[model samples]
Target chain A: MRAVEPEIVVVDYGAGNLRSVAKALERLGASPRVTSDPRALLRARGVVLPGVGSSGTAMAALEERRLVEPLRELMARGTPFFGVCLGMQLLFQTSEEDPRPCLGILPGRVRRLPGGLKVPHMGWNQVALLRPHPVFQDVPSGSEFYFVHSYYGEPADASLALGTTDYGVTFCSAVARGNLVATQFHPEKSGPTGLRLYENFLRLLVLEEARPLPWR
Target chain B: MLAKRIIPCLDVDAGRVVKGVRFLDHRDAGDPVELAAFYDREGADEVVFYDISASAQGRGIMRDVVARTAEQLFIPLAVGGGLRTVQDMRLMLKAGADKVSINTAAVQNPDLIGQGAAAFGRQCIVLGMDTLRVPGSSPPRWEVRTHTGRGGGRPTGLDAVEWAVRAVELGAGEIVVNSMDADGTQQGYDLDLLRAVSRAVSVPVVASGGAGDLEHLYQAIALGEADAVLAASIFHFRLYSIAQAKEYLAQRGVPVRRVPVPSGDR
Candidate 1:
């Protein structure tokens, strides 16, 4: 039986957490296509960028596949874009890792979190919503999400920050501006509450198509 | 929030499921594929198939069983026992095992842990340690044992709990602390061992051995602070269905996935 659901694309840039994110989207009744294919990504109602591991390596893969420019173009069109973990970090201007250049999609520098916070904060942490976004519509203010990362992004414009979490210090945990949304936590591993976020994203896709685009 | 996981451990020997008293009953339980399918339907969060037999013939049989079970089950599956080399881990992973566990091999060569983690991400590697409390020891020290609980060697000169902490630092994504004192006892989980290990490590801990009933599973979560509870004999014998176990745990306030009951089988 063919399933009728909104099509979503998860950017598989030879990184980590692609399968888990795809499965979580599936559970939310969205047909998620895990691909590095820029054409499919642009065609989707929304796109999820997921990554784990070094930022330098991730950027290289995206560059090699010629996805860096395409992704930027998609965001220019204001298609809803969500970045996760390293996926969230790559949207910034640069990273501390080798070669140091990033997509520069968001005006920010990705730096390693200072010592004493424990590298790769590998556990559940509570996130406080700063700006209201469609993704956090149903999600509570202090909802906990699963996070595993060594570095964090610091957006030049604090207005882009959608949520903040405290580890060694309060830092940006999620960001959203216009059709862009990104989270440092792996929503796929965050259990039921995380699943609800993905479901809300799917709902936003439906809503976006039903209503006229303000930019259009 | 981190998702709570429910895992079922299957003790396989010579390509078949085996259960007994203190790992010696030697009775044929059922086909590994059939049992895995049943567990998947019962909403088992994941399945672990431990190849207890280290013999060459037994190893061959285990590969076949892992392949069959992988084909039948969908959720994450982990395979352990006699996984000595990176190739061994890679083979199991290719056979559909989501994670590969190492015990004696890891102890023999601690570098294997880091090597495996580098080859495959830490999330796909697990360090399974067999532990037992030392007799007449002050402050209660737990020691590591090997060879299917037959001998203790090298001691790793490390405390059981401390070793677990080091294992995660050495790039183990998860730790499985199986208590020698609790294996097949069915009395209850050794909560003290579980608590110590769970506290010592930041990553998820799977409590194995000594889970006898529904209450035992609940205690493992509430008291031991374990992420998952693994049992062999109880599930093998049909003493408690996975559905019933999950329902009971969920009712007791332990976070568990609700599995639908099979039609005409309840």
Candidate 2:
């Protein structure tokens, strides 16, 4: 018996750490296609934008690969989308780290952590759940997730934030709006709790929706 | 608040995890991939794999070990030792390592740090500093010693604190200060050295080497002001489990990740 390949596309724009994300998906029995082609993204039952690095370079790479427009279109079409680390930052309008406009899919600004604190808020930190969401099912409200970034996103709409974490400031650590989901921490790198989040996202939003109706 | 990290470093040689006393006389610990999985399950905040192999052949095995470890292990994995170029760092990151630590190579070629940060964000690059105390200095200064174990130990003549600042300027996101004087002795971390570097750089400082008990781990974070503590022997020899170490720290009011023990484990 052959296993069907998962129609999940992990966006690759020359950023590092994509392999870890892909491997996590594979562990959950998904043969995720790591591609930068916008067409592949459009056809995916779910799209995962996983990135690490500065916004300047990440945005440049996305623009160069011709993925910006397609990503916007995918979100508009209500496809299940998940963003990790800088991928989540790019959804906002601007970043203080770099003087460039982001995808602007969501309204917000990415700003640096307050001075005197460690630049990269590296290590495990608790994510306090803002509301009940299926993506965080079984994962406790104060569960710690691995975070490695200097800048954090501040969405104009506070209600958009699904989870918040405190370093020097209490900021949005995870965001959800309809079909779009994103996290500042790397769930792929965050032990078993992290794997559960991925599983929940895949099962609830991606796989469950993709299942054919019983009548069909 | 960010939980203080407890990292268990695996000194790997020829694809096997081996621990050395003062970087001499190695003893086999176990297979790299299996030991890594064990640590991940036991609740290590992050795992570091320092490839101590002398040959290119041994380096080749690390990629496979890392790839396999990434498949099952869900924590951040850092690979160090012998990574000199941006391409080398890329090989590790592409092999599923979340971060790459550089020691000897970073000192020899400082630009390697900047180039790595430019290529793969500063967060991906870690500056591993091995320091030795000067015989007699009024202020107790230490110098950076590169290639510091087994046919290595070349002095760079740069002050440890000064060099840490320079590395951060050159784009190292985190600094791991390993005290050569205290490495295998496990007397305690070189508190003076760690405090100096931790205060000098705005980036997070990781205390490495010389952790004999849970108290040493506590001192590294409480007094030394280190963002994280990296120890090899204590956790490696099973004198204390990662959970026990975190519990000890938490008792003292140190914010440590208290990972809930999954049912049927331990």
The candidate maximizing DockQ is 2
Report the lDDT tens digits of candidate 1 across residue range A54-119: 788888899998899889988988888889988899999988864769889999988777774334
Determine the iRMS, in angstroms, of model 2. Answer: 1.6
How big is the RMSD of model 1? 6.4
Model 2 accuracy (lDDT, Cα): 0.88
Candidate 1, pairs of clashing residues: none
TM-score of chain B taken alone, candidate 2 = 0.94
Docking class of 2: medium
Q: Candidate 2: which stretches are off by over 4 Å?
A: A1-6, A206-216, B20-29, B261-266
Output the number of the TM-score-best candidate. Answer: 2
Per-residue error for B83 in candidate 2, Å, reads: 1.4
Candidate 1 DockQ, CA atoms: 0.10
